[model samples]
Target: MIDIIQPPKAKQVLKTLSMHDDDRHDDYFWLNDKENQEVIDYLNSENDYYDAVTSKYKAFENTLFEEMKARIKEDDESVPYKFNGYWYIVKYKKGKDYPIYFRKKDTLENPDELLFDCNVMAEGHDYFKLAGLSVSPDNTMIAFGIDTVGRRNYTLQIKSLITDEIFFDAIESTTGSATWANDNKTIFYTVKDEKTLRSDKVFKHKLGSSTSADTLVFHEEDDTFGVAIYKSKSKKYLIIACYSTLTNEYYTLNADTPDGEFSVFQERVRGLEYSISHYDDQFYIVTNADGAVNFKLMKTPENTTKFNNWTEVIPHREEVLIEDVEIFKDFLVISERSNGLNHIRIKRWDGTEDYYLPFDNETYTAYTATNVEFDTKTLRYGYNSMTTPSSSIDFNMVTKQKTILKEQEVLDSNFNKDNYVSERVWAISTDGTKVPISMVYRKGIKKDGTNPVLLYAYGSYGHTIDPSFSSIRLSLLDRGFVYAIAHVRGGEYLGRMWYEGGKLLQKKNTFTDFIACSKFLIAQNYTSPDHLYALGGSAGGLLVGAVINEAPELYNGVIAAVPFVDVLTTMLDDSIPLTTGEYDEWGNPNDMTYYEYMKSYSPYDNVKKQDYPHILITTGLHDSQVQYWEPAKWVAKLRTYKTDNNNLLLKTNMKAGHGGASGRFEALREDAEEYAFLLNLENITT
Candidate 1:
């Protein structure tokens, strides 16, 4: 007789949650106690059960991991960009999991100056992330943030570039960024609330001083808003920006006067959203003022930085969304999206020349990259597509000449862009809206409803998942899997209106659009339900979760990573990280209307006595964004409510956070595990 591996059973304690005259009985609520030994044991058991179930395919998983890792150029280095008379470069040594930072002074021919070797600093830590590398104006010191536990709360530290010695100053619970003032000794950074992890305070710290002596420059008292400090591109002012989902306010201070009070550039307005970029004597603003849904470009003199003084520079277009603008000494480059495609438009400051850079690909991502030098005509940009590798290019605005600085190198010798085919297809949603789907597969794929397809979508927060190159995804395409990205309504793919149509009361449009895409694929003979799979992570994970609950039969299997399954409960609790701040995104559940609507589709609450597709859920215990308990409780509830005995597994990474793994190669292992789960569902073990 064959032995069957049994899954772990979580013991549930009944807990009643009451909100707005509504009561909910939560059986697995006890799992939310992070310090509870029972909770830890239950989580460990789930991990053990996942290991036992996948032990048979360990070799295949390793093979997949190696195959994906082999495609990465081990000793890869990023394109160097010049800043403060030095060229900065980030490179990884072969077999190392972390990056090494280097710099060349004056010229590229100069000997490389070793800044930081993350491999050495990451030693003894299972999870490590270094962020916010800010060099002092004098180029004698550097401020950076480090996180060892992967919770995103970093410790800000300063180091002497001249002496190669780390300073004694250290500030904890920061957002992992520090902006330096012109006076190299002073710096400004944002600090997060310990409980909610919200960036609520901005502090000014002076070098050679204790953190306790630091001054609080600004406090974002509104629970719905967060604050951040950044230096203007012109390097003349330090700005503190307070922002919420639909509102924004900014305070500015001359960088030379580190101790001076910051003056408010604009007062807060409930529906006003704007960002500032400093030029010679004016501030360029990208805003949705005057009901500009897609946003418009406006400018105000530095001396008169107020709404009344703002004048339009670029009018808002119904079909286009102004994503960002980069200011140069002689030009302005605007990043816009129109009809789900990226457009880079360069305009001369004197209004003499205005035109857009041309792109031929039907489905590709292109955007302006780091252009630290304000005096240059060269615009550095990045471009990639589903079938093409990513390339960093520099285009001279004056000469109309472009140069490819560096292209992503795929280590596999057999890899070729022509071997794959990518195309855009439209799916008619239930609401009669046409949603776009970008799909890539092997060139010889046949639309006979027999091939395997992985449909993915992240329909939340107006975050568009563009069609971009991914060498790692080649493992799936090469294995005869068709990967498709459903540009649903919740994202800003079409325009700001597309995102508006899928959020709050209309959030169901996101799920329906994804379902429409899957059905369209099946109807078009690309893949049938038996060979279709669903995949999403975080908000995207929530997408797949709700998807399976509404139409489980549409997908043969599903993968949800760090899913926000318990939506209603999470939104109701302001104490949860990102809860209060995201009230604008996911409506405040305190209101009865939002509460009822949220409960209607929340993945955990909707799980009932019905058949479900084979599912593999993954989460990180240290995930601050979407708590591990969300997924843990979700899996427990599904096991009890789901009628089918399809594979239902949960794997928790105890060492990492929202992002699964910190190391480049280690992250591939997580991807391999996920891909293995999907491939095994198709009986494609190798």
Candidate 2:
């Protein structure tokens, strides 16, 4: 294995940058056979080291299972009506072919008992479900989404929990997640039209009726993005969040009836980015619209015509970002994050008092209220982390008491979190942009700054990869290696302006920004050229492929999972599923301007005749977003043109879609395999 962070390479990097004057010219051909041979030998050497690391932690899985089993056994509350709980977390257990211990209740351990599970949506079709739950107010009718073959083009289906009968179904171009109206009969959801860029229309479907009974409530002519609607508790004011791709616009709407016309109630809350909550006939919104990282709440009267009712309930918060807001009785429960830690806060309606809930060490990325009635006096909420299985806890807001209610057994006891550590660092980009990077590494590794680093970035599609828990990450982080996520352009970290600045003709900004991040890592003595690996999936995979093509010498290996490598071809192919809707983001390739820009950075079009990093390109066989043949054909063409064959491998998921795997354990195994590949490429722990 090569000791990559030697003092001589830093000077070499400086000399290379100073001597290179042609910025327009591509710099992908620096890799030769000598460099390629060295990388391959290092990978072979690292395999034994990774095996030893795996052997040391094999016993940890058993410990994880025991703890989870104990947690599950302690909770004894069970009800005849299993639908009375907060989360109906139906999942495939390791020992069971059918989803077992799915309901939040104790008695209903098997999903086979649920009458609804017996009904298939279509003939010869298995209803593929994702993360969705029923409204707390009425669990009688469950509003769920079903996607055929995991295309992501879902159909919202309302099933009677009692009778197991399909009440209604509405087809959507994208995700079919919907919110139940106060009456529980109407489901409101947004849909994207295949034709126009900004033709997303919000519709309401009346249950117990045909699809023709559905009515369009709101429509957008401009490619402005609008979703995440929160129906007011009063059922009169419905806040539909509307923001343009290039600008942020917040609106509140007045609904005269359950399925009435929606008129703009409040417009342009300058600093609020559409985070609003309604409690006690009032509106509480968290907005950075005020130029602060934290958020402030705005209160508006129930009446849509009165603009004067719009007032700040909570002034600009300090030191924390309000991650989520929920109405718990007379006060508001806000989940906040500051310096990587999460806290649950309770604020009074009068805005004069505040309190904190006991969630000091509890891990929950998302939390919402459900009408789950448990015998416990406290309010029970669900919480989980990457390593920690999903568990429900009864937390008392008044007394500040918490009790564990239930724990979902998803993984074995061998999963270890102590072996991993997540750290945050800021990298200065080429254009003087400060990029936030998250690194996860093995616990025993010294910051003595010499370790293989796997860098990942997306930097497109206005997607903000929030700091969330992932159990699959343990496979890599426990192996004496480092994993980092680069927050680059086309992401919403700095808001709409940041995303717009990195997209379209400025698409090169994504590539440059990512390169700058990798350079910063090396310059700061975090890692070295030979020990650096880059990994990304989906659009992020596109970023991974482009960076490797632009700077093959920078990384030891590259992993592009379900990547959009054939950008120019996919953008031009109108027959593709999401091609038309994505024109607003990537621009129409038919246009000469977009054609020129895309050709410059599109990975599939830019294969070079030089030694390259060990590339592992992964794609789902049935992926609707990114075609599988894109990676397969790109790798084939790349191998033919490449001077040095540096392990150009493609792993296609035959059983899964874009998400890789349907089951939890299968997903973890795939993640483990990818991480193992990265470790092997970087010669980590060898």
Candidate 3:
């Protein structure tokens, strides 16, 4: 047993890791032995201590959870989307933590046929997730994937839609996604390496086939690459793609030809990246080939998809990064980013009507949504901002008309967009990069430095964290807190150049960019350092860990959820799930250059005997992406060196994985806990 504030001091077991002529000592390495009883005991002790520390907020946490949950329509049903011969729908009942998947034929007036009730399946499991729901083309059977252990090793299962019998077919150790061939009986899925958990193989199975008899369709030999299985949008080809952070290679086989051998559409080339979409007799390729760093759209005859055959359809733009494209029978929907804002452009096949979708907010996210039908004149999309609820929309391409299918209903009647103000601002970084910041707050909040502000950023993996509405975020606004998102580098927010500037050797740009944003916010009187806070999850967690290490006096507190703080060790170990494939992302530590560069900012390795801001570190016991030990080891090491008496806490979810809790309502509880941690630090209690 240990005191609430004095966490159980982890017994240090010195372990040396040598690479690229360098040796590093990791004292908390013993925490990595998860199978040992002593290790489990240590984790349990920490959880108990965290529970004890947060016990006083039990009532507040519950209230916050219930308040957020109340904003959700418990009996909500998703708008039906037509596919094949049925209209698919997903609904959640009151008091249920899972969804019931259903479908109806011909009309919404017909009785719904229950496909799967996740609530029942999730019973008795501490963690459960259902995904890869693919109905056969013939609509006779369904293939789905489920994971209960939270490790993301989904078990693929099939059920007879006609006989209503759950088949004995099960494929284990998959990535939780399946693609069906046009034959409806043949299904393909990706499998991960048992040790690294890299999706390295693609397997195909026939209907009612035994798991032992599944055929291995493809195996990716490169440890730096992971594989994925998917069907072309046109439903004509089964696609197998192998990719690393820097490269992409794809192979295709006709969907109707189950036994046919796959042929490469484009051979692998270093620094070349392309994505394929089939339409008519041609394959539209979005590629960064020929030094088009911003990416360009190219079309080639389906029979010859090589580089030489590619003809430019949409030339690359220096300022705009083409993110994605959704193709229809008569239209091409382009998703792009420019000046740190997302825009959706609609261009007709004949190039007669080309225009951008109009949006009012300065910092909102608008992108292509579900568009299953290819022969339609209407386009479906999603739009949301910090002050607006997410909306599902249908835009008529011919008439230029707009119709809102549904806007997420926030049950809180007191919530109003008019009461909030959102805008885009910029922060000049040390290198003169004008970092964009999307901020929101209660309209009447003073621009005086007295306001409390929570600045969030995730600058990694070229994944942009767009500005969107969150019903839960309302609690922070109502409590007089300002929320802002730092559009820093390592993300493709401004363009491809933004991401290139923040990865590999330039990775420090991400941390500095975030720090610059914080300084700008304070200088502008949005909030002073005394009332500032930082928040990020996963890689963003890594961002907070790094930034606070470099600029400890910039914040009052930080909440890092499932953070990847132990960078050097995690990235150097090929046995870790994401290590090998992240070489291009973080750079291969096998090289001395990258090794030394990563050690410069590796949070755990750089922890010094200095004062640190208040930190709340969280992880899940079964996290597959960033293992739980990374954070556990980080917190233990931080406790050993930090001189400050600031509230340092660690909370680990015993049942969840990378994404935390699987249940919808259950996840809200964790959010409430995080919000409560921030609120309590500021002495704000309603």
Best by TM-score: 1
Point to the candidate with the largest lDDT.
Answer: 1
Q: List the residue pairs that clash in candidate 1.
A: 537-541
| Stretches > 4 Å off in candidate 1 | 1-3
For model 1, residues 1-686, the per-residue Cα lDDT tens digits are 12188788898789999988888999999999889998889999999999998998899999999999888889889999999899999999999999999999999999999999999999999999999999999889988999998899999888999999988767889998999999788989999999999999999888888888899989999999999999998998999999998899999999999999999999999989999999999999999999999999999999999999999999999999999999999999999999999999999999999999999977899989999898898999999999999999999999999999999999998899999999999999998999999999999888899999999999888899999999989888988999999999889999999999999999999999999999999999999999999999999998999999999999899999999999998998889899999989989988899999999999999998999998999999999999999999999999899888798999999999999899989999999999999898888998
1-686: candidate 3 lDDT, tens digit per residue:
13346677889999999887678999999899789988889889888878888888778989999999999999999878888778899999999999999999988889999999999999999998999898888888888899998898898888899887878656778888888989877888899888888899998888767878989999999998889989887888899998888888999999999889999999889788999999999999999988999999999998898889999999999999999999898989999888777889989888899999888767798988878877888888899999999999999988989999999999998988889999999999999989999989998988899899999999999999999899999999999999999999999998898999999999999999999999999999999988899999999999999998999898999999999999999987888898988989999888889999999998888898898888899999999989999999998999899998887888888888899999989999999999998888788866
Tell me each candidate's TM-score. 0.99, 0.71, 0.98
TM-score: which is higher, 1 or 2?
A: 1
lDDT of each model, Cα atoms only? Answer: 0.94, 0.60, 0.90
Q: lDDT by residue for model 2 over 478-578, one digit each (tens)?
A: 55567677768887555555677778888778888888889878887778888888888889988888888889888888888889988876776666656
Arrange candidates by TM-score, descending: 1, 3, 2
Error of 2 at 108 (Å): 10
Candidates in order: C-alpha RMSD to true structure: 1.1, 9.8, 1.5
Worst 10 residues of 3 by lDDT: 1-10
